[model samples]
Target chain A: MNRSAFPPLNLRWLMPLLLALPLLVQAADPLPSWNDGPSKKAIESFVSAVTSEGSKDFVQPAERIAVFDNDGTLWSEQPMYFQVLFAFAEVKRLAPQHPEWKEQQPFKAVLEGDQKTLAASGMDGIIKIVGATHTGLSNEAFIDNAEAWLAKAVHPKSQKPFTEMVYQPMLELLAYLRANGFKTYIVSGGDVTFMRAFAEEVYGIPPEQVIGTTFVTQFQNQDGKLSILRTPKLAHNDDGPGKPESIDSIIGRRPIFAFGNSDGDLQMLQWTAAGSGKRFTGLVHHTDAKREWAYDRESKVGKLDKALDQAKAEGWTVVDMAAEWRQVFPFATATSGQ
Target chain B: MNRSAFPPLNLRWLMPLLLALPLLVQAADPLPSWNDGPSKKAIESFVSAVTSEGSKDFVQPAERIAVFDNDGTLWSEQPMYFQVLFAFAEVKRLAPQHPEWKEQQPFKAVLEGDQKTLAASGMDGIIKIVGATHTGLSNEAFIDNAEAWLAKAVHPKSQKPFTEMVYQPMLELLAYLRANGFKTYIVSGGDVTFMRAFAEEVYGIPPEQVIGTTFVTQFQNQDGKLSILRTPKLAHNDDGPGKPESIDSIIGRRPIFAFGNSDGDLQMLQWTAAGSGKRFTGLVHHTDAKREWAYDRESKVGKLDKALDQAKAEGWTVVDMAAEWRQVFPFATATSGQ
Candidate 1:
């Protein structure tokens, strides 16, 4: 039965060979990239707690919901949120058609390669850029443009394509969680539609499970045909305290586990930890400067001041990427998917 | 390996076992309650198409979304929509507060037990009843009222509690699809938050995944405290074409599977069918007058005219309640959670 591996005769790694054979191939050290440390142990313990049956830690099948913050947590969020970069690229691509964009503030920054002005735009400028590039399009057009832009866009930091910047350990964790019956959701502050464009191929999270920022969309009668219009109105933010509210509004049930990267995700961890029983919260602190950029407390991209203090106070697990992960990026590097 | 049961050339199902000890539980038969026939084969083929690895029929993990219309499809929408009954009861409950409602259109019909007046009131009366019974109260207060009323009230026909009336086989199907990596959403024409109150406890479908008709919601600054308000502005109507629009806008992916009982569900079924590959669409025809009640085409509640036609023309599976399902309601009925 291969039950001898676990000690105390109570911890069984494999369920009884039930009716249908298991679907996944048990690989070499599943998530081999995750480093050796308490962070790993914390993840294993939480996963086991909710998965193992007939134990007090055993979560019911229905309550086995896990939420992940997408940016800086599951994938990379450096220099800027990837969506902003996509918007800039989108503006650049449309520059020929929109000649007046060169005279515009945010659009001018995008066109002139004036990275400073774009960065200086900060939150408001980013919103302006996103709204400008995102509007007046159909769902198909948006997906097509996003796919085209992402195929060629590289991260300013790693100098690798944007998709290559995803954390390898987190990728395995996603697969592992799905294997153990947890419905994982990317509850991020990023636009749900934008993330949905690639999440399926990247994280294996379906569009329906992604709860994030959104905009108003309308149905239009276009040339005697019905079409969907993506508008610029703010729908849901899915950040800070909004994270908890979004989880309540979108997921309905309190999850048994939550994961995040920075202070923006502090409230989400708080919400998950506050759940009734067998709760787990883990934070990914960017600390691998060699393989990937590392920063904490004072980083502009994924600031961690509030969440750092809260995690330490509450005894939440803080994953140090440099020491805790053997590999930072997936083996599918810049050219792998190609 | 005991692989003789499956064709040797078709090793997709067995390969996982050799590669990894897949959890091999008999793929949960979602339609176990239904006797084997075209209905069962149709369900199996749909699951096979979407779940089998690498098949063009292979729906991506992100696209593995299924939606169900709640009233007639997930449960029972008969005699009248459940919400309609709730409005009638609400008139009686608030009778002590608003005795004037006794002279109102729908309220008067409900109070006087006059079906003629209720029909005459029609759109105007229905809107008045919905607005009156649904708004201006705290979400918690409304849910509490629903719970109390649900506990005490009985259906006009069969004298059974409304909670006892949900279809049991559909519940199994919901659990089954979820087991096979499908995200199940209750896309109903009912109130989103209202149905959300009991949906989790009743259907195991969480509120976030419940797409339904919605009203305008506002965050109000109430004397230095922030409280949310739900207004009757008719935000999203999740019926007919509204179902597909809501699915695309909220979920961002067309569903691979859809189910419903009436013409109200025809558009949703069409939406699912229009998705690329390995799709499943079903119509739940209430054909059992013995176990439940058979009414379609001309039935006042949950008429199945268009859907029945579409089911035939488009080769969609139709669930004849009388012949297919072994049971119609959850084993435990009334008194406690459905």
Candidate 2:
């Protein structure tokens, strides 16, 4: 137990090689893309509090659970949900069957490449498009379709593949949590199975830890084979208060810490607050319009008004994107349509 | 990292003092009550595999995720589901306000303490009883009511509290897993929050790692005050393939190891087998009819048909409860139960 939990054999020399592989993944100076300020201090403090067993705020490894909202919080959930863009490409490929879609409002707008009309359709229009595109498939089938799209699809702004649009600093945050013994979960408004498609490759959070909205599914025995049929019934919505509910349903305990962006995340933060004992509730504010699009009270996507007002009062740390993140997406990536 | 994660630095010699404290727990050795044979082998193989880093089956501290089923898997789920027992008690307590319950079949049976009528009514009848018992309550209300029932409720056979009905071998299994860098999770069909109420005391597993069925909830804000509400909604069912689905939806990885007893757990065992490289799935077969119940295939409670068949086919380890477990429940303070 003292050394490597293994005997001091030459296999020990092999152990350092295994550990070195991950260290090589990090730059010589870790967190090179982090903005220098209290924002950095805040992140450092939270990590230290949960990691330092000797400190007053020390938490046991078993109790260290940290949850994050995907989409805007992880990558750019701007212009449109990246998954929506994936759905659009899928719709075009499947367009041969749906001749009627050529005349439909959102579908016609999307097919005609009119981003304005598609935007005008709003959340209602988006839901209809996603449901139509994602339903009528097995869980495996849906995952394959999403993964295929990610393999080819590029972001509108970052020009990189949607997976590359992931925030570099947030990636650092995820690794930091893992290094500190925290189990991380991706609780998002995105489709559960859809996120599961590439969440492992992108976030290092496995399919099992991705909690999101689900289409209704039915277990069926077909020709002595077991299969579950997928339908467009709203199963679980991992949004707002549903975040905490889903956490309870899946993880079964109130998270010691939570992070999110927008009013859609307000309920989750509040539910986290009701939990007794030392807790942390942090919100990611998308306020870098220069580097990244910024909108709060007036934005349709990832609206952060109610959460902003409560952040200061609740003493929840609000990370200012422009001031906190030295970089958004990885430098290896380039802007969209570049 | 070699030293204890928790140290008595400021209070010197505190570790020695703490170690000297009499452990309140009983049956650290799981041989006295466990029946014997394969059940013992299953336990042994699991501990040996995880602890042996050179065995090629060795699991790293970070990758060690172990899942266990509740009810029949951890404790006896006979007569009826244990959670149902709790629900039945709560239903009766609230019966004075619901006059219609007297006219209902299961409720009428439950209220009158007529075990015969309740048993005769069957699954449909049981569902009716559960719905009547579990709904119309807040999350806090449900948890408080459950804890109250647990405090007073006793097993008819043991005459001790139901909490004491936990398998002593399983407690040792949990501690052993943690000792080998594994995080143990109780994925049960029982109410999610309900299990968490006493899991820390009963199982070494903390509340956070427990996953199960859930109710819908709402976050309500009154002026500046906020609270969450619980509603009757099917969240996730941690049974059958649902066990694997829940594991995927919550844990974020395919556990390298799993344990369960009934046919209800066959899919979970299969899921564990599909894990990459090093994997183990242990099935606890209840063969000790003298001490417990021995019915497997035909027994409505804890039916083990699919799992027994699969264990043979897949070369999975099948543990015989009567022969393998040296002890079952913990003894009262002394080496024997009162």
Candidate 3:
């Protein structure tokens, strides 16, 4: 074969084009689950501004921190938070060990499945249940218990795994932001250990990236083995103003973008907006009674009255689930059909 | 161009080899400042075991967490911790505004440059100095004050900038671990804000990776501007057992490798060592009195007594500084002939 008969295939120029083609093909719609609306437009434009080099709003990759509220923002919080359900289940599971719980009000209510009595018991009762169930175990043991429960547990209303109840549009948004160099974080009211179990798998957020309400932990050396023991005391709540406090303490940088669903996230939104740059503050307004639960403002769980007003006044993106989302859960097709 | 007279370049076969050649050449000794010794050999072998695929001790890249103690382990902590020096400088800088500080014991001692009286003031006086200087300012202001002091602050004996006092061998080790897919973190007895000020520039560890002692801070909305206000109240003292506690709280994973120089880091080392599989724990023994301060059990600052005993008993790698390190500070040549 004469070498002169063959045309030179320039591998240097051709290889890069070949490699980049697949990426271009894969990067079709970053927010496919999102319906074309003001909510999606706002998100897209904000990301574009921050990521584009030479743009006035461009933020360095290191400074592109994006925080999210977990309970209502990322996943459904209807019928009450999923972690509370886990706590109630835990109380029932440990009932056999605690015979005294058969007499105690909240524990008895939990064991007997008396929802009315448990609801009537209020914050004190919830704290008592959390303190009992969430403490005294090694952190590894607690994580194991939470993971085991999450493995099989189903959401009562949706008849799906709790992890499956994550908002598809929001999931798309998280991916979109991350694709644009934003570091996604879960700044939630959920306990750190509990959220850490599912966050990594479900949301692609790592354990270190999840900041949440924390309980005091002690280092225990049992013989040669070591364990972190969870104490009953609450170290940080990570709700309301506590969100920004924990964000500053843990991340040591203010996020340029924040998303939330209730009054608990108001301070976080306010804090993010106060940064001197082109920032994005968004709220997930529960406005679809059909696909998902729609109660907000007057609802006991994930109340959005003050924050809703602020969102409207500040021109922040308020995601109208009914109109803005083409899909609800990851398991369901567009509109969920259920 | 006469095609019959030319030969094919075979670029396809040539490109990859050309790209890989530089990498091969650049991957020289990972720790250049580390002398050929038991300590360096132990580190190299442990890294090889964990990073090698199919090795029984191999760790996944995400799980390769390495924690380091900042004060005596990474840099010189004597004549005293650099942060304490900054605090003393802050007192002097702010003394003119506080007329009452002239009569205060610790403040008067600081202002008068009375080392004996200041040393006599002990921890309580030190706390008073820290409370006055480290808190009541916004986190930004506190960091600004710290950075300003660090920029000009020089070690008394070494007469080098405090940041330059970081151990060259340790810096090389940190970079080496990071190169092999390990995430480096500073779990130090120093305050998080204080350490974060220089961690990224000095040790290549980011702010989020620096876990340390923290004072309580409040999220303040001053009109439209937001700031995290440092409060005087002690939130968590990240020393002794607190080291492991904070590591678990922030990182949410057990470190496979840890380095320290004092009893304050003993718990962190124990925590890392207790993790299942191949682990590395190290301590820097300050035996180089001519080059650096040498003190162990009897030293008030950077005490190494208990931790030295633990390292010996646990078979942890202890770097005998005088023998193991070819260089101490990055600014100096092989021997720092100060």
Candidate 4:
């Protein structure tokens, strides 16, 4: 009689609870900042499929390489690219040294806050400005100047430090992937050294993992001390087609995951998707006008035109920022604009 | 209570044993392949000092960067560089495709097995041979070819695979540094792509961590598939001054430790030593003619003149292969000749 009474106490209840315990703990949401949607689902599923042991889609930890475009994908890239803004500010800072800059077309446009003329100056004009402002300094000095500027530099719209404006969802994604054994790398169009100045602090990506446009540097032995001097000459233009080329040359392995925000990342995504095995590609579409600056085909900085089309055709996840993200910037308060 | 009665259990006997436990376990010879000598002492002491918490010489894990030259420093480069041998073999492999190579100066020299003529051709001639054989293939194809050749190719004298010819002491050193949280990188003059094919397997260094001379690669999209095609154009010559330049551009941080066996690594050593903290510089002096081929100033491959002199003047550790290393090649048996 006692056995019958105790047996009815139902071990069934504990069975389901025990079964759900592993799922609850093992599947803690890696990307909490991400709103529950297809983009987040795509990322989570891909990571799970690749990381699960004995699964056909399982990729070894060493082969789980992920590449991300730095500017709009990882952080805000408007009113213009942050590095370009730095160049403009540098133009103003160095204008006293060269009074001619006050009259120079691009430099004058930069000094006068003329966005239209600056855009009209084209890549050649931009290169000249970058050369004039970004070169001839030792790497240490350049890094110091960049770091100091970054420390104080605020976004034009957000009025928050640029580093603080990095997308919280993306940061979560980066950490999520890294925790899943993915080696995250920044394959950006920005200056490699400039990105290195803030990458580790802001993104938790070390300098060695930040691959970007490189300026020619010369090793100088001056008075028994050695220094690497940055030169104006562009060593590798890691943009568009250059992205895949640089990744192949530098990383040597084709990445299984790639994230980008513009046409400059088109080839990279293509290259990643073309790899033999499961691959994941994501495009951060800036559709959040109120929370963050929204621009696509018509916008100059971080233009998302061709890559947007390619993402649709290739079944790549297109992250509609306004909808997919519960929060935009890491520093955003309830009342603060994204 | 029974202090005198039990003779205090000889408590003092346990003191030295307990104190030595940590020293015995934690300080087990990390570099057993290295003999008990100044070179080993220098390496052990440098590692201990930098890794010791609260020590003035303590380097943060992130800052514990070490760069190693691949050719003579990690592996044997005598009887001509193994990569050069590979190039020569490639020239022969592709002779059918280029009938003109039969008559071309450098190509003809390589195809004809004319070492004297190839040597007489100087750097220019060698470049021609490398350009002819090491280019035109897609990166994947080139790496496949390189890996296939490495799989089958044996050293002319030792009959050992080139990878097996790597020094055991250096391998131990690499593992030791890695165990101490040091990031190891290969900053070599060898082709960056070539070294990458076997770097991970041979040295436990990843492709992204291998910095070397780069050949220009063009992104090719063929039938909706993306491939990076290696070109004959030399992009960056990562040797001598270029070593420091490439290290700065690629690694972004100055290495605290640098190891090399040639003048080509002079700037790298200088740059490492010139860093603002305690640094280690090691020169692998090829002094074991009987055990391994020895040629320094007079050798075309792995020249070790200027750097050797500089190492002595700068107090950099000079590792004599014969004396400092208990074993040279990793596969060496006790009775095996160098």
Candidates' chain A TM-scores = 0.88, 0.87, 0.94, 0.90
> Order of all candidates by lDDT, from best down to worst?
3, 4, 1, 2
Displacement of residue B322 (Cα, Å) in model 3 is: 0.4
How good is the docking of model 1, as DockQ? Answer: 0.21
TM-score of 4: 0.92
Q: How many Å off is the CA of B25 in candidate 1? A: 14
* Native contacts present in each candidate (fraction): 0.28, 0.41, 0.65, 0.74
Give per-residue CA lDDT, model 2, range B230-322, as digits (tens).
Answer: 666665566777877666656656788899988888877777777667787888888766665677899888888978998988888887766
Better of 1 and 3 by DockQ: 3
Q: What is the C-alpha lDDT profile of model 4 across A197-277, one tens digit per residue?
A: 999999999998999998888999988877889988889999999999989888888999999999999999999999989
lDDT of 2 by residue, A203-257 (tens): 8886667888876675444654544456788877778877877776566667787
- The deviation in Å at residue B25 for candidate 4 is 3.3
- Give the TM-score of candidate 1 (chain A): 0.88
Tell me each candidate's TM-score.
0.75, 0.81, 0.94, 0.92
DockQ for candidate 3, C-alpha atoms: 0.51
Q: lDDT: which candidate is best? A: 3
- What candidate 1 gets wrong by more than 4 Å, as runs, is A1-38, A52-55, A119-122, A219-228, A287-300, A320-327, A330-338, B1-65, B87-148, B167-184, B193-209, B214-235, B250-252, B261-263, B278-338
**Docking model 2 quality class:** acceptable
Q: Give the C-alpha miss distance for residue B205 in model 1, angstroms.
A: 5.1
